[model samples]
Target: MNQLQSLKKITTVVADTGDIKFIQKYQPKDATTNPTLILQAINLSCYQNLIISAIKYAKLKGGNHQKKIVNASEKISVLIGSEILKYIPGKISTEVDARLSFNKEECIKKANSIIKMYEEEGINRSKILIKLAATWECIAAAKELKKNNINCNLTLLFSFAQARACAEAKVFLISPFVGRIYDWYKSKNPNEIYSVKKDPGVLSVRKIYKYYKENNYKTIIMGASFRRIEQILALAGCDYLTISPVLLKELENSLGVVDQILNNEKKYYKNNQSLSESEFRWHHNQDAMAVEKLSEGIRKFAKDQENLERILSKNF
Candidate 1:
């Protein structure tokens, strides 16, 4: 078996793209999307129909120019997610607008709106995982949404504090990014070459995986944003790994023995105590990489969201 087939034996592989063709090709159990990916897919000829549908939906909803554009952007997001859901058996994570990342109330409201739109499309809430930036306010919003049985996947997680808080809040999932973390460290030491095992990104996810399993936290850790197939191979037995299509194809071609590097049986350091919001903030602040990356991530997503809006507006 190729590495992809072997890896699937131990971990749930998820496709991290808005493009349905890749999702269908990889046949990942789940799929995830954000504005950046949606924007990329919108320019493709195949997705033009999805855009048209979103335009019609937005027009029928009836709002002012800005409101209509926002509505259409949201519609296209859900529409893409809805289309992807038909192929994958597990949930699809549709993100809340990153502009609302720090506003607890707006985040919650937007998540609910996404959920409602999915429901209207005949998709059950179970098949959708509302994604929010892993900000303190967004965590609070996720906590409330969880009470209503709206499972959330907190994205842009870069610190243990973020994971700890999400676990305490009983979030359904947390996507701790591997590639982005590696990129940050690599930027600092440009001349230094890091091995796969010593890669900071791989090490971070490993630490989080062991901590979650040791503490028996229900929040599943999905290692995402992979820069190379070696990182994916290193995390062969994680709960989930949302990989892009290019890396997924690489894994499919390479024939290798993928071992289970992570499992629940191993004992590791554990933090049983929950973090208060301030404590969480303080701990997260101490990590310079996390601080910068989290902020940078939010800004990038917000910009892509606006770009998606502009594309939607032009089509109308």
Candidate 2:
């Protein structure tokens, strides 16, 4: 079997893109889309009609251009999500506005609104996972949303505290970023201080995975934003991973054998200890790497989301 096929035996592979064509090719179990991916798709020639049709449909409903544009953007998002679900049997994760990351109530409200919109389009809630940032307020919002039977995918997770809180809340999944962690370390230390095997991103996800498994936390860890195939291979046994199509294709083309690299049987220092919020916070804070990456991830997502809104304004 190919590496992609071999990896699937141990982990659920998810395509993290708005490019439907790529998802069709890789045939991932599930798919995920962020504002940036959707915005990129909107600019592509193949998907231009999707945006145009959504805009026309919005105008037909009778509203000003701005309202029409907002409606169109939402429609495009929903359409892309629904189309992605056609190929993947598992759930599709659609993110809420990163701008609302810090507001608990607003985050909850937006998540519900997005869920409602999905429901209106005949997409069942069971097959939809709402994606949110892993801020303290967002975790609190996720707790309430879980109570309402809404599943969430906590993205932008860098610290163990964020993952711990999400797992404690019984979130459906948490996407601890991988590539961004590598970027932060590489940028700060231009010197070749780390090998691919010991890349900070790989180490960070392994720590989070070990903690989750040791504690029997049901919240699934889905490593996201990978920059290289090595990072993905290092996390072969993670519950799920959302990889970009380009990396997925590269993995498909590679010849090296892929095997399970992580599991509960592995020994870890934190294996015997349970983490509390205070301990989680202090430990994560001490890891200057995690602290810096988490902040950077949030800022990047917020900026991309703003750029998406600007794109909507121009053509809507």
Point to the candidate with the largest TM-score: 1
List the global CA lDDT of all models: 0.91, 0.83
In model 2, the worst 10-residue window by lDDT is 266-275
Stretches of model 2 off by over 4 angstroms after superposition: 56-68, 266-285
lDDT per residue for candidate 1 within 1-316, as digits (tens), equals 8999999999999999988788888999999998899889888787889889889999999878888899899988998999998899999999999999989999989999999999989999999999999999999999999898899999999998898899888899999999999999999999989789799999999988888888778898999999999899899899999999999999999998799998788565556678988899999999999999999999999999988887778766
lDDT of 2 by residue, 21-63 (tens): 8988999999999888887888777677777777776777668
Output the number of the lDDT-best candidate: 1
Our model 2 lands, by Cα RMSD against the true structure, at 2.9
Clashing pairs in 1: none
Off by over 4 Å in 1: 266-272
